[model samples]
Target: MRRGVRTEEMQEQERSKSGLLLRGRLAKELGQHDEAAKLFGEAAALEEALAQAYAAQGISEQVWRHEFSAAGCWFQAGNFLRSLELCDKLMATPDAPETLRERARSYAQTLRERRDRLWTELLQSEHTLVAA
Candidate 1:
């Protein structure tokens, strides 16, 4: 096998981030949305833990990258609030890269709008029920 090629032994050794992401993408392509989301959520959580560890070690680039990745995975999993929370934190990090900060800002807006829309729809449905 080539240097970077994955082997069976490597696969059996751990549920690594790349493996989880690959599995999640496979599940998504199989139309198993919930399963894919679950896998993505797990990936997101793992990324978050990595980010926290990097942060503790004062590695700004790795921390920002992992945080952004975790936020993206949460978004894929439809966990908007968690994604938005991480995005917001990234946006607020003064030392984080501008590109990532810009992306986070954009994600935050979309997440906020989505959250507000859900709340508004729920309220409207309740009002309709009460009126009826």
Candidate 2:
């Protein structure tokens, strides 16, 4: 039946999503940040695709979670701008849960502070080099 096929397809997609998340976690634990970031990004894309297929089914919760995970991955990978962009996306979503929005705001602040510190350190190093 059509319903059975759709159910099976959804289950398969869920499995794939889980696998990606698990692998991304493992990569992060192992300090393979770039790989973890790539895997998380893929998982986020898959979540978006699944959302499209389901026509907004559980859209707000799922999108916020996936985006948050991807944003964390980007942060770990030192891609601050991308992480901040994802945080911004989450914050801008009208239907996002309050908890998710709070997390995004926190992450954005952390990213901004981290970026500013890195820039200052870099500028200091450059100045030292020029003076030397």
Model number with the top lDDT: 1
Cα-lDDT of candidate 1: 0.82
Model 1 ranges off by over 4 Å? 1-15, 115-132
- Taking all chains together, the TM-score of candidate 2 against the true structure is 0.65
The global Cα lDDT (0 to 1) of model 2 is 0.75
Give lDDT per model, in order.
0.82, 0.75
Q: Where does model 2 exceed 4 Å of error?
A: 1-58
Let me know the TM-score candidate 1 reaches against the reference structure: 0.75
lDDT of 1 by residue, 2-54 (tens): 12333454334235877889999999999999999999999898888777666
The Cα RMSD of model 2 versus the native structure comes to 4.6
lDDT of model 1, residue 23:
95
Worst 10 residues of 2 by lDDT: 1-10
